[model samples]
Each structure stands twice: as C-alpha cells, then as structure tokens.
Target: MKHYYFFLVFLLFTSCQHFEKQVPSEKELLQKELKAINWKEVDEYPSFKDCDKLGNKTQRQQCFFEYLAQLIQEKLSIDTLSILYPELDTIEVKVTIFPNAKMKFEPQFPKDSVAYDTIKIDSILNARLVDFPKVNPAIKRGIPVKTQFILPVIIKVE
Candidate 1:
C-alpha cells in the first residue's frame, strides 16, 4: 500500500510539472502582435459612400482614387490655373485624409522648376478644394487610420 501511494503521488507530481507553462507577459504579447501586423498595407483603404460597397480591396481602392481625381479635376477646371500656366500639363497634389474624415490637399512643385508661381497655385488649390463629399477613413485592425497619397492631376485647356 505504501509503494502504491508513493507511485501515485510521483505520477501526480510529474504530470503537474509537465503542464506548468511560463505564460508570456502582457508587454511581450503586445510586441509579438505588433510584429505580426503588416505596417505598409492597410486592411481597408479610405473610401467614399459609392466606394464602400465594392467587394474586392483593389477595386475599392481604385474606385476611390478615380472618384477623387475626377472631383479635383472638376473643381480646378473653373479656376485660372490653366490660363496662368498653359505650359504646365500636370500637377502632383498630395492628399491627406484624416481619421476624422477631414481632407487636405497640397500641390507638389519641383524644386528647380520656377515656371509657375507656387504661392498662387497653393492658394488656388486651398480655396478651390473644399466641400468634398463624406469620406470614410482607412481601416487597420478594425481601427480608423489617416492615409496620404500623391495624385497627378492633368490641366486640360480647351
């Protein structure tokens, strides 16, 4: 009976030891999760009301970009940018969309290029680019995030 009791106790002790695992700390778990996430790509791109219904990620992104470009082109068409800078064919505009759905547009000019007045273009863009439709911010891990991209807008003179 004594030997049997000792064997049972020994088995219990060994089994408990095998089950004991060192649980990682909260900070360590968070670090591991962050490392696993891809920082370069967003799970969902910033979208408009018309763009949100698209099933594919790439198609949704493309629709959003094209819609934005068309809006910009339409707004700037009435402005005097084309008349002032007829030689300038296209302008690169840096667009930033905030999580709060606010948008900012800034014109990107080449450093060495002095053909057009930068201040005039900046003011025109700031004044013209307003009252845009509601934009849903980008999503990453179910959280809204700010996104920025440069878009080339063509200045067509009729």
Candidate 2:
C-alpha cells in the first residue's frame, strides 16, 4: 500500500510538470503582431472637417481628394503660373499630410522638362498654397498617421 501511494504521487507530479507550458513574452508577441500588420494601407484616409460626416471609407476619401483638388485649383488660378508657363496645363503635385495636420506640396516634374523655371514654380506654389481649411490626419489602427498622394492639379490657363 505504501509503494502504491508513492507511485501514484510520482505519476501525479510528472503529469503536472508535462502540462506546464512556456508562455511567450510580451515583446515577442508585440513583434509578431507588428509583422502581421500591413503598413502600406491605412484604416482611414486623411480628411477634412467637411468630409468626416460622409458614409463609407471610399466616399470619405473621394470627398477629401476632390475638395483638396478644387481648393488647390482655386488658389492657384490667381497665381502667375498660367502666365509664366503658358504651355503647362497640368502639374502633378505631391501632397503630404503629417500626423500633426501639417501639409506639404511639391510639384513633380519629368526628367527632361527644363523649359519651365522649377524654382519659380516652387516659390509660387509655396506662397500660394496657404491658409487651407482644417484637415484631419489619417488613422491607422485608431492612431493618427502621415499620408502622401499625388494630386493632378489642372491649371486652366484660358
């Protein structure tokens, strides 16, 4: 009876040890989750106050882009770009919105287009693109993030 009790106790202790599992550390789990996330896409696009009430992600993004393009077109219409570069009708502007709601606009030019004065155009853009309406930064996993997109600004020279 004593030997049988000792064997039973030994079996119970060995079984309990086998059931013990090594839990992963917090840092390891975090790293794994980070790897699993897709950094290229955001849960929500950057938008303006006017666009916030729109339904669905696609509609909100469309409204934001259209409004921004319209504003840019209106602002630049009074500038001297149409007069300075009469042949240039369209300019691809790279717009970047930071997490803090700051914005930057840079005109993208092709490699061989040297006829237009790049410096003058940049100065004009910097000077003209100001005092824009309030913009909300993009959201990624419920956190604000920076976003960049190329906007084709149509310059109606006529």
Q: Which candidate is the best by lDDT?
A: 2
Candidate 1 CA-lDDT value: 0.93
Per-model TM-score, in order, reads: 0.93, 0.89
Which stretches of candidate 1 lie above 4 Å from their native place?
1-5
Q: Over 4 Å off in model 2, which ranges?
A: 1-12
- Candidate 1's TM-score reads 0.93
User: Distance from true position, residue 74, model 1, in Å?
Assistant: 0.5
List pairs with backbone clashes in candidate 1. Answer: none
What are the lDDT figures for the candidates, one per model?
A: 0.93, 0.95
Leading candidate by TM-score = 1
**Residue 129: error of model 2 in Å?**
0.4
53-85 in candidate 1: lDDT tens per residue?
999999999999999999999999898899988
Give residue 116's error in model 2 in angstroms.
Answer: 0.8
Per-residue lDDT of 139 in model 1: 96
